[model samples]
Structures are given as structure tokens and as C-alpha cells.
Target chain A: MTAVAVNNIVKTYGKKKEVAALYDISFEVPQGELFGVIGPDGAGKTSLFRILTTLLLADSGSATVDGFDVVKDYKAIRKRVGYMPGKFSLYPDLSVEENLNFFATIFNTSIEENYELIKDIYIQIEPFKKRKAGKLSGGMKQKLALSCALIHRPSVLFLDEPTTGVDAVSRKEFWEMLKGLKQQGITILVSTPYMDEAGLCDRVALVQNGKILSINTPQGVVQEFPYPLWAIRSDKMLALQREAAKLSSVQDIYPFGEYHHVVLKKGSTAAQLEEFIQAHQVDNAEMKTATPDIEDCFIALMKPSIDTATDSLNENASK
Target chain B: MRTLKFLLQKEFRQIFRDPSILRIILVMPVIQLLILPWAADYEMKNIKLAVVDQDHSEYSRQLINKITSSGYFTLTSYSGSWEQSLEQVERDKADLILQIPLHFEQQLVKEDEAALFMAINAINGVKAGLGGAYLQRIIGEYNREVRMKWIQFPRFNPDTQIEVTSSNWFNPLMNYKYFMVPGILVILLTMVGTNLSAINIVREKEIGTIEQINVTPIKKYHFVLGKLIPFWILGLVVLTIGLTISRLFYGIIPAGSFITIYIFAAVYLLAVLGLGLLISTHSANQQQAMLLSFFLMMIFILLGGLYTSIDSMPEWAKWITRFNPVSYFIEVMRMVILKGSTLVDIKMHLLIMCGFAVGLNGWAVWSYRKRS
Candidate 1:
């Protein structure tokens, strides 16, 4: 069963300027699937979550959560879906227990009724249940927010950038909690700017500039990169990057931590790039075939669109 | 119903947990009630009098003595010429100048009437008007005294003299505090009901909690009521404290039944809080809500007949008071607390307030969209 299905959702803001936040976006989340909308800030991830959760109306398109239309059956969808906005939206002055209980009661359910569902996440923050939510540290706040979102045992959960400001450890723990919820057959749609978090999802839609770049399983997205990719390491990494971009065969070049993950043109070999790097007198450069990850795939998919976007912008600016 | 209960629980918990809200709820009424009634006293006193005693006769001295001892005027400048006293008026030192003419005693005895020229600085209109009225009353008293001493055994010429005896009925002592306390209490209730509820929703908007609530299955009326009921209760709580302070400090017991006041107060809070929620629906943040609330409050409190009588206001201002909710509550408070007006007497006001309650709350609920 499809837990969430969005069809050509287009949303724009500002009546005069009409900046489109989402444009012809289409996707679906299957039942019990942990879906991720991976994008950087201002990429319309929050806008998509708000529209699906029925807090916002899309300019043009139809969406359904749990088989209920987002616009037509909003009330029914509201009952079945749990939404955690990008910002921490819980009452900061209420204590942890109060915040959790408050959400439970509004949904006409009690904490004891769904104790098993939120028990793991709740137990972590239960010790500080008396403390005000605003006083909690970043990780504890994220955990409390998740607990509040889950108190009603919603069938479809929408978490928009839940781990945005959280530390590394808490981010991992949060994903683990999402995994556990998915096991209980709750369809979760979570958005994040962190590309690494995409690997943990059952499927991800790489979103940029109000459109989806790709939607596939983690391995499928990486496997779909139809190019010979090379990771070149050298003492003079900056010089190597400048030199590698000059090569006729290099398709894309971006610095990825210790190595620059370089994509070569179709039918190009790694040896051609190596000879070019050596000829440039780049110090101690070593090249090897590198496995593409989601970040590499995201950049490869996003770069060409970005170039065209700038090209159109230049055209408009000249006019 | 259960959603409303949970929302109210959360609202009250938040209100109690934030010390700033508690301070506003507790401290505002106590300070405004205990202090404003005393400070807002409208019985003008300390009128600076510059007396130019040109006559310096026995009658002029007696008249000056009477005016100074009337407890209203302080003899600020006593000089020979009216010009010197005029200088006092120019310097802003004197509010009224009383000039006793030459041969004033002889002219009074021979002609049985005397002309006194008085120059009143008309700046600060209220002070000047009251000061002139006070001086005239004192001189009239002195005239009556002289008439009594000079007349024969028949104390009054009943046929010729027509004396108008006027007495204050409600609030017989004419205590300014008695009148001001009830009006101040109404104002305190208004601030608590309007500003608090206005800021409460916008605070949620600013902090992003309203989005979470918007996505819930909660009904719109339930959400608005959850915001309304607690502050409505808090407004009544503020009224209770204000009434207690008025009774304890100013010795003002309501002439009417407390039940009538509470009944009216309950309905009044609904209209005010509905207006607040309406503002919150338009506002995007706490600052916008606060500014809008303050702007409305300034207009409401000023034209609400708290400082000035509505009947005495100009035609345009009277129309504003007709629409102002604060004016109705202030009038109702004074009517019940001073005149012992029963619910039947204020039935029109009660009916209008009900209209306001229904209209404003209905409009608020209609405008508050759960989705945007």
C-alpha cells in the first residue's frame, strides 16, 4: 500500500515575484518504508513536508497521506499523520513529560496507550522529564520532539530536518530510532541536508531547487552513475584540482575530504587523467577508481542543472 | 472536547511555568489597582492663586482669607498691582488671578454690588476651569455671609431668593476613588484578557508551535477556546484581585450584586479575548501582536469614559465609544458598583455585549484558518 503519494505538487510564494518553492514534484512512499528527502537548506524539503502534512496548500497538485487526500480529506489525514516541522515546534516552556502528554491528549490517546511505541525514545529523555523543553540540549530536544510526534502512534510520520542541528552521536541515534519505528510498520518520511544520512534510508529522493534529482535505493543511485569515476590524492590537492579540471576528459571535479572525486568523460580511462596530473607536475598524485556514494551521485546530478539555471539567470540579467 | 482539554492543560502549564506571564497576571493588577485609583484622582486641588489686593479692605482680606482657607487654592502671589500678578501668570506660576478693585468695600456697601475682575490663565483647560469655578463658589459663600450679617430678623426673602439644592445620589461622598476603582478594575481585566491572549498565540507562531497544532486533528474552535478560556479565567482572576484591593484599601463594596458583575465580566472577557485572537490571526509574531494590542488599547482606554465622560466628548469621539468594548465594560462597572444597577437596568448593555461576544468570536473563528 502507498502510505504517501504526491503528484506534480507545485507551490510558489510571493504574489508579485512568484518564486517557486516546489515545482512539479512527484514521489511516493510505500507502506512501512523509511523514506528520505535529501536536500540542502532552502531546497523545498520543508515545503513538501508541510504540504503533505496538510499544514499548507500546494499551488497545483494533489497529495494523499494514508490514502486520504491532503486538500480534501485534510482532517482525516491530520489524524493519521504525525508531522515534526523543520524547526523545534514543541512548547518550550512545557516540561518534557507535559509536552509528550499534551500531544498524546490532543490526539485523544494516552501515553500508556502508546507506551511501547515511544518507550525507547522516551526512556532516554524521561530522566529529565521535569525540565522545561527549552532547557534541554540539542540531542535531548530532538529526542523529545520525536517522542511527542510519536505519542499518538501515527501510521505515517513526517519529520522535516529533525537532525539538522543535532550533534553527530544524536544524529546516529535518531536514525536508529527511525529504523526501529520502520520495523513496527510505520511509514516515515524524513528530510535532511546530510547526504550520509541518505545511505541509512530504504530509499531517498535527492532534491534540489524545488525539484527531485533522483529517487532510488542508495545502491541504485550510486550504481546509476554511468561514468568512470577517479579519486586522486596528492600533497598539492588544490593544485591537482585546478590541473585536473583543465583535462579534456574530466567531466566533473569536486574535493571530497582527503581526495578529489573526479568523474571522467564517457569512454575515458584513469591512466589518461594520471598522465595529465603528472605532466602538470602536481606532487605525488595517485589515482584510483573510486566507488560513488550518494554525495557524488547528488553532485553529478545537480551540477548540470545548476549550470543551466545560472545560464538562464544570466540570460534574464542581460535582458 | 478532549483536544480542548489537552490544549487548555498545555496552555495553563505553559502560563504557570513562564515567570514573565505569572508576573504580568499577578503584579499588573495589584500595582494598577492599588496605585492608579489614588493617582488618577480627578478632584482638582492645589490651584495656584495670585491675589492682587487693590482694596486691602476688611472685606477684601475676609474674602481672600475665605478663598485661601477653602482648601482648594494656595495663595501663591499676593501683590499690590494686577500687572505683577499677570507676570506670575505669564511665568506659569499662577493658575488664577483674583483682582480686588479700588473702593471695593465702599462700592459694595453703597451700591449693594461690586465688580471684581479676574484673569484666569486658560492654559491647562481643566485646571483653569476648575480653579475659576472654585473661586466663584468661595466668593458666593462670602457674599452670603455678609448678607446674613447685614439683613434684618427675617433670615430669607423667600419670594425673591430661589436656592437650588443639589446632592450627589450614588456615591454621596463624591469619592473619586469609588468611581475610579471600578473603572481601573475594568481596565486591568481588559489588559489581561486582550494583550495576554493576543501575545500568547503569536508567541506560538514565532516559536513554530502553531504549525504542529495546525497539523493536528484539533478543531479550530477548540484551539481558539483553549487560548481563550485560560486567559478568560485569568482576566476574572485579575478582576477578583482588583476588587479585593478596592474593598480592602479604598473601602468600596459594590452597590450591586457580585453575581451581576461576574456575569457581565464573563461575557465581556469573551469579546475582548475574541478581538485578541482576531489580532493574532492577522499578526505573524509577538512584536506585531504587542504593537497592535497597544494601539487598540490606547484608543479603547482613552475613549472608554475612564478619564473623561462619554457624554461630554465630541460627536465623533462618542461614536468611537459606541464601538469600543472597553467603554461598555467601564460603563457597566460604574453602573453596577456605584448606582446599584441591577441586571435588568443594564439589559441593553448586556445584550450589546452578547452581540459583541458572538460577533467577534464568530468572526475570529471564521478567520482563523487551520490550513494556509
Candidate 2:
């Protein structure tokens, strides 16, 4: 069963109605599946989450959550779906326990009734349950928010960048909690800017500029990278990058941590690229064939559109 | 109904937990009630009189003595010439000048009438008007005394003069506190109700908690009612606190029943809180809501006939008072507290208040969107 189904959803903003926040976006979350919408900031991830949660309306097309239409049957969908906005939306003055109990009661259930559902997340923040939610640490606040979102035992959970501001350890713990929620037969549709978290989802829709570039499993997305990719490194990274851009065989080159992940054209090889870099007198330059991760696949799919956008901007600048 | 209960629980908990809200609820009323009435006195006093007595006769002396002894004027300057008294007014030494004309005693005895030219500094119009009226009344009384002494005892009253003895009804003492305390209490209730409820929903919007509630299965009316009820009760509590403070500190007991005041207040708060909630619906954040409330409140309180009588207001301002909720409450408070007006006397006010309550709240609920 499909927990969420969205088709051709488009949203626009601004006074003149010019900026498109979402452009013909379509995807689905299977029942009990851990689905992810992976994209960078302002990539329409939040917009999609808002539309599906019925906090916002789409300009066109339709969506449903747990078999209820988002626009037409919003009330029915609201009762069954749990949405944690990217921003922390719990009352800051209320204590953690009060926040949880408040959400539970509003949903017409008691904390005692939903104790089994939120117990795992609740236990983590239970020690500071008496403390105001605003006074809690970032990780603990997220935990309390998740607990409040789950207190009613919503069948379809929508968490928009829940781990956005969390620390490394807390991010890992949050994913672990999501996995646990999935085991209890809850379908989770989570969005994040971090490419690493994509692997954790059962499937991810790589979104960019209000459009979904690809929707597949982590490995499946990686396999969509269609060029021979190589990671090139040197002491003089900037000089090497400038020199490497001059090569006709290099399709794309962008700095990634200690190395620059470069995609070579179909007829080229890593050895030829290494030789070409050495000829540019870049010191201690090294090259190796690198497998594309979700990040690499994202960049590859995002490049053509970004180039066209930039090209049009340049065209306007020149005019 | 159950959803409303939870929302109310959360709202009350938040209201109590926030120190600023508690300060507004608890400390504001005590301080405003205890201090405002003492400062807001409207009775005019101590009008400076610069007397220029041209007629140095016994009657003129008696007149001067009577004017100074009336307790409304302080004889600031007694000068020889009209120019000197005019200088006193220019120098801000006197509020008004009393110029007694030459041959004043002779004119009164021979001509049976006297012409007194009074030059008044009309700046600070209320002070000038009241002072002029006070001095005129004392002079008129002195004329009556002189007439009584000249006329034969029993034959004086039967035919010549018609005396009008005026009596003040309701508040015979005309105690400004009796008039002021009820008005201030209305203002207190208005400020507390309008400001607190105005910020309640916008505070949620500012902190983004409204988004969470919007996504819930909670009904819009339930959400609006939850915000309204707690503040409505708090507003009544403020009215109660203000009434108690007035009774204890100022010795003011309303002539009418407390039940009447409470019934009006219950409806009055609905209108005011409805206004607040309406502002919250139109605003995007606390600051915007507060500024909007402040702007409207300044207009409401000033034109609400608390400080000034509605009958005395300009035609345009009077028209505004017809629509102003604060004006209606202040009018009701005065009518019930001072005049002991029954519910039937204020039935129109009650009906109009119900109109405000329903119209504002209906607009608020209609504008308050759960899905936007």
C-alpha cells in the first residue's frame, strides 16, 4: 500500500508569482518504507513536505497521505499524519513532558495510551522532561519534537530535515530512532540536505531546483552516474583545479574534501588525466578511479540544469 | 471539545510559565489600579487670579474677598492698573484677570446694575472655562446677598427674582473618583484583554508552534476558543482585581449590582478578545500584532469617552465612539456604577456589545485558517 502519493505538484511564490518552489514533482512512499527526499538548501524539500502534510496547498496536481487526498480530505489526513517541520515548532515555554502531553491530548489520546509508541524516543528526553523545551540541548529538543510527533502513533510520519542542526552523534542517534520507528510499521518520509543520510533511507529522491532529478535506492542512484569518475589530489589543489579545467577530456570537476571528484569523458582514462595534470607542473599530483556516491550522482544530475541557469543569468548580464 | 481542553491546558501552562505574561497579568493591574486614579483627577483647582480693583469701595473689597475665599482661585497678584494684571497673564502668573470698573459702588446703588469687564486668558480652555464659571457664580451669589439686605424681609422672595437651586443627582458629591474609578477599571480590563489575547496567537506564530497546531486534527473554532477562554477569564480576573483595589483603596462601591458589571464584562471581554484574535489572524508575528494592537488601543482609549465625555467629543470622534468597544464598556461602567442603571436601561448597550462580540469573533474565526 502506498502511504503517500504525489503527482505533478507545482508551487510558486513571490508577489508576481514568478519563483517556482516546486516544479512538477512526483514521488511516492510505500507503506512502512523509510523514504528520503535528499537535496540541498532551497531545493523545494520543505515545500514538498508542507504540501504533503497539508500545511500548504500545491498550485497544481494532487497528493494523498494514508489514502486521504491532501487538498480535498485534509482533515482526515491531518488526523493520521505526523509532521515535524524543519524548524522546531514545539512551545518553548512548556516543559518537555508538557509538550508531549499537549500534542497527545490535542490528538484526543493520552500519553499513557500512546506510551508504547513514543516510549523509546521519550525515554531519551525523559530526564529533562521537567525542563523547558527551549532550555534543552539541540539533540534533546529534536528528540522531544519527535516524541511529540509520534505521541499519537501516526501511521505516516513526515520529518523535514529533523537532523539539520543536530550534532554528529545526535544525527546518528536520530537515524537509529527512525529505523526503529520503521520496524514498528510506520512509513517515514524524511528530507535532508546531507547526502550521507541518503544511504540510510530505503529509497531517496534526489531533488534540485524544485525538480526531482532521480528517485532510486542509494546504490541505484550511484549506478546512474554514467561517466568514468576519478578523484585527483595535489598540494597545489587550486592550481591543479585551474589546470584540470583546461583539459577537454575532463567533463566535470568539483572539490570534494581532500580530493576533487572529476568526471572524465567516455574516451578518456584516469592515467591520461594524471599525465595531463603532471604536465601542468602541479606538484605531487595523484589520481585514482573513484566510485560515485549519492553526492556524486546528485552533482552529476544537477550540473546540466545549474549550467543552463547560470548561462541564462550570464546571458542576461551580457544583455 | 476534548481537543479544545488540551489546547486550553497548553495555553494556560504557557501563560503561567512565561514571566512576561505573568507580569502583565498580575503586576500590571495592581500598579495601574493603585496609582492611575490618583493621577487622573479631572477636578479643576487653584486658578491663579490677578485682581485689578479700580473701584476702591467697600463692595469691591467684599467682592475681592469673596472671590479669593472661594477656594478655587489663588490671588496671585493684586495690581493697580489693568496693564499690570494683563502683564501677569502674559508672564503666566495668572490664569484670568478680574477688572473691577471705576465708580463700581455708585453704579450698583444708583443704576441698580454694575458692568464688570473681565479679561480671561483662555489658554488651557478647561481651566479657563471652569475658573471663569466659578468666579461668575461667586459674584452672582454676592449680588443675591446685596439684594436680600436691601429688600424688606418677607416681601423679598414672593415675586421679583426666580432662584434656581440646582441639585446634583446620583453622585451628589460629584466625587471624581466615583466617576474616574469605574472608567479606569474599564480601561484596565480593555488593556489586559486586548493586549494579552492579541499576542497569544501571534506568539505561537513567532515561535512557529502554530504550524504544529495547524497540522493537527484540531478544529479552528476549538483553537480560537482555547485562546479566547483563558484570556477572557483572565480579563475578568483583572476587572475583579481592579474593582477590589478601587473598593479597598478608594472606598468606591458600585451603586449597581456586581452581577450586572460581570455580565457586561463577560460580553465586553468577548468583543475585546475577539478584536485581539482578529489582529492575531491578520498579523504574522508578535511584534506586528503588538504594534497593531497598540495603534488601535491608542485610538480606542483616547476616544473611548473615559477621559472625555462622548457628548463633548467632535462629531467625527463621536461617530468613532459609536463603533469603539472601549467606549461602550466605559459608558456602561459609568451608567451602572454611578447611575445604578438596570439591565433594561443598558439593554441597547448590551445588544450592541453582543453585536461586537459576534461580529468580531465571527470575522476572526472565519479569517483564522487551519490549513494556510
Candidate 3:
């Protein structure tokens, strides 16, 4: 059974000449599967989560959560779905236990009834249970919010950028908790800007500028890279990028940590490009043929959209 | 019902946990209730008077002495020249100038009547009007006394007389505090109900917890009721504290039954709290909610007849008061406390308050959207 199904959803904001926040977006998450909507900031991931959770109305389209219509059956969806928004949204003044109990009681359940679901996360924060949520560190607050979202044992969960601003260790622990929850057969839809987190999901839909660039498994997305990518490094990386942009065969150049990931045009060889750079009197430039990751594909996908946006902006400016 | 109960528990916990909010809810109203009534009194006293007595006769002297001894007027200046007395008025030393004509004691004996000119500063119209009327009453009494002495009539006199004795009801001493305390109490209740509830949901929005609550299965009316009930109870508690202070400090006991006052207060809080929720629903942040509540409160207090009589207001202002819930509560409070009016006496006000409670709460519930 599909836990969430969205089709042709479009949302726009502003008073005049509305700017589209989501444009004809369509995706689905199957039952008990951990699905990830991967994107950078302002990529409409939050908008999609809001629509699926029935907190906002889509301009045009239909969605369902746990087989209940988002609009027509919102009350039912609200009962069965759990949502932890992008921000830490639990009552900051409320203690950890109070926050947990409040959420449980509001859903017509008790803390004891769902103790098993949040027991793991709750135990870690139990020592500081009397502390206010605002006083907790980032990791503890994240866990408390997650526990609140899961208190009623929701069938489906929507977490929007759950791991953003969290330290590396907590982010890892949070995903481990999510994996454990997935083992209990809870369908999860999580959005994150971290490209590394994308690999942990069973399936991910790469979103950009209110449109989905691609939807595939982690290996499939990396397998579909059509370019012979190369990682090139030199003492002066900025100068290297500037010089490489002048080459006719270089399609894109982006800085990735110590090396710059370069995508060449069709029919261009990395060996040919390496020898060509060596002949240019560049100082100790090193090059190697590299396998493309999700970040590479994400950047590659983002280029055309950015280009089209600027082109339309130019067209409108000329008029 | 269970959802509402849980929501109320959360609300109460949040309310009582914060020290600042507790101070605002409990301590602030008591302080305001104690201090406001003494400052809000409208009874005018200590009118400064300057008498320009050009007539040196015993009758003129008697009139001047009567004016000075009326207890409402203080003789600030005694001068024979009207110009000097007018100078005292100009210097702000006198509020009223009495100009007695220069008759040398012959005009009143020869002619049956004498004319006197009284000049008063009318800047504060209420004080001026009341002072003029008080002086006129004292002069009228003196005239009657003089006429009775001159007549020396037998028991078979031809003239018919009617003596009028007037008494002030409800507040026989005409204590302004008796009237002002209840009005100030209504205002305090309104401040608690309107301002605090206005900030309630908006604060959740600011802190982003509203998003979590909105995504739940709790009904809209349940959410609104949960938000309202805590403040409603707090409002009653504040009213009770205010009533206790009024009795202890000001020695005011309500003429009507406690049941009637509590009943009206309960319904009035519903209307005011519904207004607060309506404002919060329309606002995007706590600042906007605060500003809108303040704007509405100014209108409610001014038109609610707290310090002024609604009957004496302009026709349009009077019309506006008809729809003001605060005005209805103030009116009901005064009628019940001062006049000992029964529920039947305030049935119209109660019905209008019921309409306000229904309409505002319904609008609040309808305007609160889980989806935008």
C-alpha cells in the first residue's frame, strides 16, 4: 500500500504575479519504505511536506496520506500522520516529560501506551527530563521533538530537514533512530539538504527550484551520470577553475573540498584534457578520473535550471 | 472533550510556568485595581471663588458669606472692583468670579429684584457647569430665606409653596469610588482576557509550536476553547481578587447577589476572549497581536461608559456603545452592584452579551485555519 501519493501539486505565494513555490510536483512513498526528498534550501521540500501533512492547501493537485485524501479527509490523515517540521517546534518552555505527555494526551493516548516507541530516545534524555526544551542541547531537542512526533505510533511520518543544524554525531544517531523506526513498519518521508544523507534512504527524489530533477535509488542516480567526470587539483584552485572555464570541452567546474569536480562535454576524454592542462604551464596540476556522486549529479542537474531562470530573467529585462 | 482537557492542562502549565506571565496575570490586576479608582474619581470639589462685592449692605454681605460657606467654594479673593476679581480669574487664582452690582443697599429694598453677574472659567466644562449649578442652588436658598423674613406672614397666607427634597439612590453619599471601582474592575478583567489571549496563539506561532498543534486531530472549537478556558478562569480569579480588594480597601460590597455578578462575568469573558482569539487568528506575530489588541481596547474602554455617561455622548458614539461588549458589561456591573438589579433587570444586556459571545467565538473558530 502507498502511504503517501501526490500528483501534479502546484503552490504559489505573493499577492501579484505569484511566484511558484512548488511546480507540478509528483511523487509517492510506499508503505514501510524510508523515502527522502533531497534538495538544498528553498527547494520546495518544506512546501511539499506541508501539503502532504494537510497544513497547507495546494493551489492545484491532490494528495493522500495513509489512503486518506489530504483535503477531503484531512481529519483522518491528521490522526494517522506524524509531522516534525523543519524548525524545532516543540513547546520550548515545556519540560521533556510534559512535552511528551502533552502530545500523547492530545492524540487520545497515554505515555504508557506508547512507551515502547519512544523508549530508546526518551532514555537518553530521561536524566534531564525536568529541563525545559529550550535549555536542551541541539541533539537532545531533536530527539525530544522526534519522540513527540512518534508518541501516538503514527503510521506515516513527515520530517522536514530534520537533521539540519545538528552536529555530525547526532545526525548519525538520528538516522539510526529513523532506521529503527522504519524496522517497525512506519513509512517515513524525510527531507534534508545534506547530500551525504541522501545515500541512506531507500529512494530519493532530487528537487530543485520547485521541480523534481530525478527520482531513483542512490546507486541508480549515480549510475546515470553521462559525463566522464574528473577531479583536478592544483596549488591555486581558484585560478584553476578560472583557466578551466576557458577550455571549450569543459562543461562545468565546481569546487568540492580540496579538488574541483569537472564535467567535460560529450566526446571529450579526461586524458586528453589532462595532457592539455599539463602543456599550459600550470604549476603541478594533478588530475584523476572520478566516479560521480549525488552531489555531482545534483550540481549537474541544478546548472540547466539556473541557466533557464537567468535566460528568462534576461528575456523579461530586455522587454 | 478529552482533547480540550489535555489542551487546557498544557495551557495552564505553560501559563503558570513562566514567572513573567504569572505576574501579568495575577499581580498586575490587583495593583491596578487598588490604584486606579482613587485616581479616576469624577466628583468636583474645591472650586476657587473671587467675590467682587461692590454692595456694602447686610444682604450683599450675607450672600457673599453664604457663597463662601457652601463648602463647595473657597473664597480666593475679596475685592470691591470687578476688574481686580477678573485679574484673579486671569491669574488662575479663581475659577469663578462673583460680581455684585453697586446698589448702596437701596435697589433691593426699592425694587423687588437685584441682578448679579457671575463669570466662570468654562475650560473644563463639567467643573464649570457643576460649580455654576451649586452656586445657583445656594443663592436660591438664600433668596427663600430673605423672602420668608420679609413677608412675616400669618398662617392664612394666600401664596402656595411646595418643598422639594431630593435623595441620591444606590450611592447615597455619591461616592465616586462606588461607581468607579466596578468600572475599573471590568476594564481590568478585559485587559486580562483580551491582551493575554491575543498573545497566546501568536506566541505559539512565533515559537513555531503552532505548526505542530495545527497538524493534530484536535477540532478547531476544541483548540479555541482550550485557549479560552484558562484565560476565562484567570479572568474570574482576577475579578474575585479585585472584588476582595474593593471590599477590604474601599469598603465596597456589591448590592446584588454574587451569583448574578459571576454569571455576567462568565459570559462577558467569553465575548472578550473570543475577541482576543479573533485577533490572534488574523495576526501573524505577537507584536501584531499586541498592537491590534491595544487598538481595540482603546475603543472598548472609551466607548464603554467607564468614565462618562453613554446617554450624554453624541448620537453616533452612543450607537457605537450599543455594540461594545465592554460597555454592556460595565453597564450590567453598575446596574447590579449599585442599583441591586436582578437578572431580569439586566436581561437585555445579558442577551446582547450572549449574542456577542456566540458571534465572536463562532467567527474565531471559523477564521482559525489549519490550512492556509
Better of 2 and 3 by DockQ: 3
In CAPRI terms, model 3 is classed as: medium
Residue lDDT tens for model 3, B185-268:
999999899989989889998999989998988888888889999999999999999889989998988899889999999999
Q: Which stretches of candidate 1 lie over 4 Å from their true place?
A: A269-272, A280-282, A304-319, B54-59, B81-87, B101-114, B143-159
Looking at model 3, residue A213 earns an lDDT score of 79
Say which prediction, candidate 2 or candidate 3, comes out ahead on lDDT: 3
lDDT of 1 by residue, A147-196 (tens): 88998889999999999888899999999999999999999999999999
For B65-99, candidate 2 gives per-residue lDDT tens digits of 99888888999998779998998899999999998
Candidate 2 local lDDT, A210-285, one digit each (tens): 9877788898777656779899888889988887877878888999999998888756667768677677554777
TM-score of each: 0.92, 0.91, 0.90
Candidate 3, after superposition: displacement of residue A182 in Å?
Answer: 1.9
Tell me how large the interface RMSD of candidate 2 is: 1.0
Best by DockQ: 1
Interface RMSD of each: 1.0, 1.0, 0.8
Clash count of each predicted structure: 0, 0, 0
**After superposition, which runs of candidate 3 have C-alpha atoms over 4 Å from their true positions?**
A279-282, A305-319, B48-120, B135-162
The collision pairs in model 3 are: none
Q: How high is the TM-score of chain A in model 1?
A: 0.94
